[model samples]
Target: MGLTSTASASSEPYGHYYDEYSTVVDVTDVGADATGNEPITPVLEELRDDDTLLVFPEGRYYMDEQFRFTGFENFGVVGENATLVPANYYDFAGPQYRLFRLGVSYSPGDRIRFEGFDVDQTAPDTGIRTIEAYAAERLEVRDVTIHGQHDSGTWGPGMFNVTDPDGTGLVDQFRAPDGGAWINDTPTAGDRWRGPIGIVANQNEGTLEFRHCWLGAFPDNGLYAANGNGKIIVHGGLYRNSNGANVRVGGNGSEIRWPTVEVDSTRPEDRSQRGIRIENGRNITIHGAAVTITEPEPTSHAISVMNTCESARIENTRLELQGEDVNHGIVLSPDCGEATIADTTIAHETAGGYPFWIQDSDRTDRILAEHVTITGAAGDAGGFRDGIRCERNNCRFNYVDIEQPGRSGVNRNAIVNTANELTVYESNLRASQHPYIDIGANALVRDSALESSSGREAVCLYASSTGPAFKKNRLAQGIRDLGATDVTTWANTYE
Candidate 1:
């Protein structure tokens, strides 16, 4: 009892701990029965694994089976007002169903701890899966709370399936809210209900931290980690209404600093749901995120750096679009390699797509957008579209600001270059219709502010648009150059 203070000085008759070796068991003195219908997993498998400390001092505990903890080091499990209720996925007990299966995948343990607790899986059609940890090095799960409704089927149960790779861990203030789906039935082909994940870090190598968490409505992801080589940190979380992505990083050097990913447009089957999905990952970093998509028909996208992500970085992010078929607001696919979007803010009242979509793929190269801000909303006849749709070739837009107020028929353009070393500096390109910088080759628009109140042309230049350059620009209208040939307009100012 040398080490004390495990927190729980108040909060009514529950939550309390104190461990410093001295070893404490207290599973109802030994008989075990907290009014939760007998079988407390054979008195917690008869504790005593080096430096033991298991104290569940206040209430319901009835696990049917699958509560195995292997090869512990400095184990600990303290709960005040504890509650663990399993036994309902075909009455559990087969093929690793799990209510708590801590440590032992490749076998590696060290200071494992699971504090406070409440795993009341609502019951009804229950599937079950509240916790499953393995390869623990310094694992710590604090203040847990996972309440029912995970929809069953699919293989059921999935609230936390950790996998410590090398060491270091902490999942604090965790809360998994009613995440379960696949009601209409479908999963007999191989069984698959571990999808509605609320907190998943499977192939982890080390360093896994998720603090102040509150994840709800999961169908597929809500704070995940895939081929984890290591490093996954999500500082303050509140991931809601997820069907696919509410925070997903393929785990290389993952970091989602300030999270608030929302998507609950009356739950239109989740409308594909995506608020933060960075696949493959290398140096993925999404700082200060506040992605919202009310989902009128949103098919996904509010931040998607796909596939071969290399040096992905989106800073000071904020992508909001209340509804009306919200689509893209930052998507760089086709083998995305180098990317950096700084000081971002892509706002669209009722999105029509493209707030920054670089496609053409050629294994995408340099895409740097600085001090960006792309806003659009103006009646949505066909919905407002295009703010930056490059074809992916050494793209760069400095001090960017593209505001569109409607119109623009045949494919809309407020800045739609077809790649080829495009660069637009000191930008502010407003759109209403015709070409507000739609050039194609080696493009360059310096000191820009190309307006188009109802444009016919403000730099159209198409015929392979070779070496096109419009210097010192401030064009209201002019410069069509359809058959473009070595065009170079210096010190421009067309009214």
Candidate 2:
């Protein structure tokens, strides 16, 4: 396994790089007793100012409380095929003790590194947080597996629950379904108790990265990286079988932070939640990855981007099905947030859902939808759906194909545009019935083939002539101005 930033430091030919750093301490030998049922704090305190802690060359160790550390610089904790178990699940639920607190307030000028370890929670509700890098730099968590269960009956599963505690403080009594015994009755209580991915960074201005790891299975989300005003990146990891969402990225200010989260969804469809969610952040990029929520019969939506994001990109991804009636493959609500979705394929979505649904987000301008394909299975009789539905202005769509089965029912709109200044060009709009394109106001439909049922208009422009222009459309019927009987002919040759 390669380290996040230290891949160049080729000290060890195989295994982890810490093997080259001789100043290593075996937690068990240092009085921690890897197999002992006690906390590892005593052994962790005895280490030198700069030492690497090793555990379980091939075994497991359980931890009950949050791992607390202080006064260590360039500290390293390494393990392979080893497990760090929590003493009790309750310790991380309501009390929320972080598994490890690196760069403590008292010791502000220290560094910590974790590698090749299997970190899990004893109870379902307990979350697995790696470290909160406060004022610390050059920290890395690589080749480590953080595991937890979405014990539906339990309070919280894999990650930390920072929200308000639920009615049942214990995980055993909580009531929901599927995974654990503790499943809350209230709608809001599900994520509140289940906790998200344990790795959280608050108010930090440093570089933090997690590489080649497995992170997921919490009540709320898989990972929560918030209050961040620095550089953050995640690459080459597995996020699956989780309860809530997969990842959350946000922060205050406009200093333009660089945060890139790329996850390889290479597991069974039953291993994850929402793909990637970004709220209140800027300068974000999600590229070279895949997202699928497969379970519950047919899968639901894959990814959702909302709440004022800017300079965002989604490319080279696939979304598979899990359960039935899971609508909207990707929901983009970047109100005033500029984004681009290109070269992506969304298929096998059984439900007559929108592959790309963008609405009422701030900036309508600077949105580019290109070379995307959305198709449904054969014998799947349903129409009046959309390949891409946008309700914002200044939007542009080019070279996209939206195909649907069956005739256009009263419920479908192949391509819905409600923006003030919208443009649809060089696209294939194939709806088996009704209208292929439905325009709201001030839009332009150029060089696009709008094909639908016979006698129905190909482009339904409900806009006034002074609102926008409709030209270069190949359709059965020409553009129909709102409330006007006369149809305006464009340079388009009818098919």
What is candidate 1's lDDT per residue for 183-248, written digit by digit as tens? Answer: 443223236543556667757777888887887777667776756777778887788777777788
TM-scores, all models, native as reference: 0.41, 0.74
Q: How does each model score on lDDT?
A: 0.71, 0.52
- Backbone clash total for model 1 is 7
Among all windows of 10 consecutive residues in model 1, the one with the lowest summed lDDT is 8-17
Best by lDDT: 1
For each of the candidates, give the backbone clash count: 7, 48
Candidate 2 lDDT, 1-495, residue by residue in tens: 112223433543223555545465455665665664666655565564554444445556656545555565566666656677755444433334455655554454254555556655435454334444332434544455545443323323222111111100010111111222223532224545543333444444544443443444444555555555544455545555444455555533222112222222323323335666665667666665566554522333566776566557777666654334444577877563777888877764444556777876556557888888776632222441666778777878888877654322423445777656677788887655434444555667778787765456666655342355557778766554466233345688666
